[model samples]
Target chain A: MTRFALTLEFDGAPYMGLQRQPHGPSIQQHVEEAVHAITGEQVTLHAAGRTDAGVHALAMRAHVDIEKAIDPFRLMEALNAKLRPEPIAVLGCAIVPDDWHARFSCLGRSYIYRITNRRAPLTLERGKAWQVSAPLDAAAMHHAAQHLVGHHDFTTFRSVHCQAASAVKTLDRLDVVRDGDGIDIHAAARSFLHHQVRSMVGCLVLVGRGKWSGEDLKAALEAKDREALGFNAPPDGLYFAGAVYP
Target chain B: MTRFALTLEFDGAPYMGLQRQPHGPSIQQHVEEAVHAITGEQVTLHAAGRTDAGVHALAMRAHVDIEKAIDPFRLMEALNAKLRPEPIAVLGCAIVPDDWHARFSCLGRSYIYRITNRRAPLTLERGKAWQVSAPLDAAAMHHAAQHLVGHHDFTTFRSVHCQAASAVKTLDRLDVVRDGDGIDIHAAARSFLHHQVRSMVGCLVLVGRGKWSGEDLKAALEAKDREALGFNAPPDGLYFAGAVYP
Candidate 1:
């Protein structure tokens, strides 16, 4: 069997999530059905990260094994053709070593959250970004985000149902910058717990709006209690930017 | 009566065109309806440019005369609230002079055409950009676009149904630039004929695709005949960027 790595881009408005579920459609189900139609082989597809509902991806990485002898370009073209009408595009495809894994062998992951800071309703950027009617201080948010870097117990930031065994993880980078009328929050880590990025972003927004100061944010982080969290951002603004491997 | 100038932003996918059409909905009709709903006055709306169907707008300029004693901010807020579920927004509103006109008083007009030059189909940018699968040489396109600049007979670049009195008009700027995987063509002039921008862009794409050369483009412009036109680009990629008034 040849393992083919695929780089995917999709609009998450239609799918339930990245992983397949019995409730509704997903990115996995669409891609798997396209592969089965092309190769007539029932195979499972594994992704570097399982994104939540209404979450987009710019370059989500995935690997699928197929016994059929097909060219990488042709496989990609066929899969893209079959995934039509749906907002999914295979940006690239290549053959990988047998031991190369998409999930376990990943060295790093990155995500970007978009927030449109304006009172005017979004027209061109609707559904693609989170619209915050209130003004945001990007510099202050950046200053507060630095405190969340490094190893710490992120219990206050993670979801109550998160399946990760440990509450402690090292955050390599967390940056907040203003782009045009919007703000971008970039997060990078080896791995992340469920809702960690959104939870942190929600609190950072409160700080930016002057509802909470940097000291208050630090105190909340030290509390390590879910009830101490300020807010939980919606999944609309988050994007799985890309995955890195060594 | 107070004449209010409004800066509008809209996704043009839902309307037939910017003008009040006899058969279908339009941007002008929607804005007029919103004004009537807010002020109880059936006012006529005039725009700086009447964009074609499926064309978007970033900062389209329009004017409406209202007899109601309402502030600019309140009018903008009310119009925005009524324009919801229609993908249209009033970005800004200001009271202009009684003689100020949205169409005739405009000194300069600018437009941007976005072309996604890539092999894969667009996902997030679907219906928002024109996707050209073939490779495009932006430098070559830019070089050829210079031939269409300056004063000349644009009959070959306008629709046959164009109603302008004279075919002679001066083009101040015509620049082609590459932005990531997309190419942007910016055109500015005191005014333009019907289908002028789309016609110019279609011929430029041919030059980019190597089907025509810079010399061929110059010859086409000199022909001054509508039959000399190569093609007319789709309305999907066109945007009424903005207008300037003296």
Candidate 2:
């Protein structure tokens, strides 16, 4: 059996989440069904991250083991052809070692949250970005984001439904920058608890709106309690950007 | 009567065109109906340009005469509320002079064509961008684009059904720039014959792919015949970016 690594890009507006659910469809279910149609094998697909519903992904890594004697290029083309009508694409596919795991072997992950700061309602950017009518101070938000960029208990930012064993995780970076009419918040870490990025971004937006201060963010981290969370941004603007490995 | 200028942004994937057509819906029809619903008066909406079917607009300038006394903000808010679920928005609204015309008074117009050069199919940008699987040399396209700048009888570029009295028009600018994985072509002119920008971009893509040379583009312009055109790009990638006025 040969293991293949696949790079994926998708608009997550229609799915319940990346993983399959009994209630609704998912990226994994569609991919697996496509694979079954092509190879006639019921196989399991593993992904680096299981993104929430309405959360987009620029490049999400995954892997699957196949016994068929098929080339990577043909496999990618066939999968893309079958996945048609669905907002998912296999950007790349390649052979990988059997030991390489899509999730367990990942070194780090990164995400970007998009906020369109404009009074006008979003037409072209509908469902793709979060719109805030009030003026936002991106510089101030950047200052507040720095407080969360280190090893700490992020319980205040994590969701109550998070299945992670511990809240302590090292955040590699957190950056905020304004581009034209929108603000982009980039976050990187080895791993994240559920809703961590959105929660942090929510509070940062408050700082940008002059509703919270940098000190408030630092204090929230110290509290390490879910009740200390200020705000939780929606999943519409969040994108699972990338995952890295050696 | 008061002439009100409305700045519109829309995703043109669903509409037949910006102007009303006999067979399908249009941006004009939607706006006119919405206006009538709010003011209880039959009105006509005039635009800076009549974009083709499937052509998007970022900030399309239009004008409508209304007898009802209403503030720009309130009118804008009401229109937005009535146009709900549709991918259209009123970015701005203000009162204009009685003599001002959306088309005749416009001194210049600008458009942008987007090409996503990649092998993978688009996900988030499915209908919004033209997917070109081959590699494109944006610099080569830009160099070929310069040959179309300046005054010329662009009969080769104009649509066969064009109703303009004269085929002669001055093109102020044509620029090609690559942004990440996609390429953008920006065109500006005092006026344009039907399908001018799309025709030019289609030939530029050929030049970018090494199928045509700069000399070929010049020859096509000199031929001054509709049959001399090499290609005509689809309206999916085209956008009515802006309109300039005195």
Candidate 3:
């Protein structure tokens, strides 16, 4: 069997999540079904990250094994063409060794959260960005983000349903900056638990709005309690930017 | 009656045009209806530019007469509050002289046209940008755009339904540049004939694709014939960026 790595871009508004569920559609099921239709082989697709519902992906990496020998570009084109009427596209494709796995071989993952901090309501970017009518202190938000840069038990920022065995992880970077009328939060880590990014962004947003202090954030992290965290930000502003492979 | 100058921003997808139309909803109708609902005044709103359907406005200027005595900021807030559920917003408000007119008192009008030149189809920005799956030479497009910068009879680019009395108009500026994966066409003039911006962009796109030369554009302008133009680009990419007043 030959391993193929595929880069994907999709609008995550219509799917339940990356995992297959009995109630709604999933990105993995559509991609696997498309591959099966083209190659007549049942392929299990593995992704670097599983984004929540209503999120988006600019470049998502996945690996699948197939028994047939096919051109990478042709396979990408065929799969993209078959996934028509759906808001998904195969941007790039390449062949790799059979041992290269999409999830286990990943080095890091990156995410970006977009927030429009404007007094007026969003029109063109209504469902695509988190809107905050009150003005935000971006400089304060940036200053507070530096406190969460190192490795720690991030139980306060993890989902209640997270299935990770350990609560401790290394955070490579966490940056917050203002761009035009919006604030962008860039986060990177070796890996993340469920709802980690959203939960952290929620607390930072509170800090931006003067509802929470940097001291409060520190205490919450030290508490190691999920109930001590702030509200989870909506999935609209979250994006699975990309993943790195060694 | 006091003359009020208002700054507006809107998504032009649901309107027929900026002006009042017999068949469908117009931006004027929405603004006027919202104003009447707020102050019980049936006033007509005049704009610096009359943008077409599917076009957007980042910052548009307008003027209206109000019989009620109201502060500019309060008027703006009340009008925006009453215009709930609409895709229009009053960004700013100012008091102008009685002689000030929205259309006639404008000094210059600026427009921007966006094109996403990429192989993959757009998902997030589908209706907000023009998607072209071919590579474009932005330098060639810029070189050709200079030919139409000075004063000339722009009949070749004007629509058959143009209502302007004279086709002779001076173009203050016309610039083409590439930003990341997109091409931006910026144009400024005292005024423009109907479909002038879209038609110019269409011809420039051909030049960017190496289908036409710079001299071909000059010849088309000199001919002053409608049939000499290439085509009218779609209205989706057009935006009334802003207006500069003296």
Reported per model, the fraction of native interface contacts reproduced equals 0.67, 0.73, 0.36
| DockQ of predictions, in order shown | 0.80, 0.79, 0.51
Output the lDDT of residue B60, model 2: 95
Error of 3 at B203 (Å): 1.1
In the range B24-143, model 1's lDDT, one tens digit per residue, is 989999999999999999999999999888999999999999999999999999999999878999989999999999999999999999999988888888888898888899899999
RMSD of each: 1.2, 1.4, 2.0
Clashes by residue pair, model 3: none
lDDT of 2 by residue, B14-95 (tens): 9999999999989999999999999998999999999999999999999999999999999999999888878888988999
How would you encode candidate 3's per-residue C-alpha lDDT over B67-163 as one tens digit per residue?
9888988888887887667778888899999998888989999999999887766766766789776789999999999999999999999999999
> Could you list the iRMS of every candidate?
0.7, 0.9, 2.0
- Candidate with more favorable, higher TM-score: 1 or 2: 1
lDDT of 1 by residue, A1-246 (tens): 999999999999888999998999999999999999999999888999989999999999999999999999999999989999899999899999989999999999999999999878888888788989889999999999999999999999999889999999999999999987889999999998899999999999999999999888999999999999999889889999999988
TM-score of chain B of 2: 0.99
Model 2 in CAPRI terms: which quality?
A: medium
